[model samples]
Target: MLFQILLTLSIRFFLFDFVLFKSLRNHLKTKGYFFRKLLSCPFCQGFWSGLGVFLATHLIAYNLSFLLPMLSFGFVTAYLSMMTTAIFYPLIDKFEKNYSTL
Candidate 1:
């Protein structure tokens, strides 16, 4: 379990950290108007939003697993990963809007 958790976190960090940073940097350069008006910092805001989405998805998966015996933890983890990626789209938009203004 520890190994799995570590592996999952490593993957998440590796995939997201640079992507998020770059995204913020790009948004700051290209879309300054939106971000400043929204009162959000792309790097900081994106990190927290991503973290929140990850945590919420995992919590939901874990809670549901209790009622669904056939749902393995691995399945939940995989689903969460996919879901996390999908959730990033809207966050990117928000980040762009928030950071561009600043």
Candidate 2:
């Protein structure tokens, strides 16, 4: 579970926050404004990315009990991962700024 949280944070910070926006900037300009806006925002991107990571973790850690209650556990795990990513974004931003100067 802890590994999943950390992996989600890394994906949110690197893939969604850095690579996607930078690499797709030109392409997004010619695309729908809403799609561009959604991808550019870290929080929005993080939510979806975290959910993705959660799904991957769920697949790896699958157990019969995890689906006993209609997949509620998976949903809750993903939501929590997303929220944690959002909450730590500011700190991650600061770290990036500092690291870039090193």
Candidate 3:
């Protein structure tokens, strides 16, 4: 469970906060105002990344172990990762602020 959360969190951070995707994000922004807005919001990023994580882990678990439950793990993980990512975003922001010149 913790691994899922952290993996989801890292996915969100990489997609939205990392500098590697700066060009992609800019292209997305140019595509539409909504795309730009979604890319800028951690909550939105978290939701999408969370869902992605859930689907990935779910598929693996479902195929590997025939004991997967009927729980809404996808949505549950989405919300959980969303909330956690939002909570941790400020710390990430602070790091960028402090070392943006480096």
The per-candidate count of clashes, in order, stands at 14, 0, 0
| TM-scores for candidates 1 onward, in order | 0.30, 0.51, 0.63
TM-score of 3: 0.63
Per-residue alpha-carbon lDDT of model 1 for 1-102, expressed as tens digits?
A: 545544564555454444556666556656677654322333333344444444545544556544353244445555555555566757867777788766
Best by TM-score: 3
lDDT of 3 by residue, 1-102 (tens): 779778877887777768778789888988988998888766566667766776677654545342333134445555765676667668877977899799
What is the per-residue lDDT of model 2 for residues 41-61, given as tens digits with 9 covering 90 to 100? 655565566567766665445
Better TM-score candidate (1, 3): 3
Ranking by lDDT: 3, 2, 1
Determine which window of 10 residues in candidate 1 has minimal summed lDDT.
37-46
Q: How accurate locally, in lDDT, is each candidate? A: 0.50, 0.61, 0.69
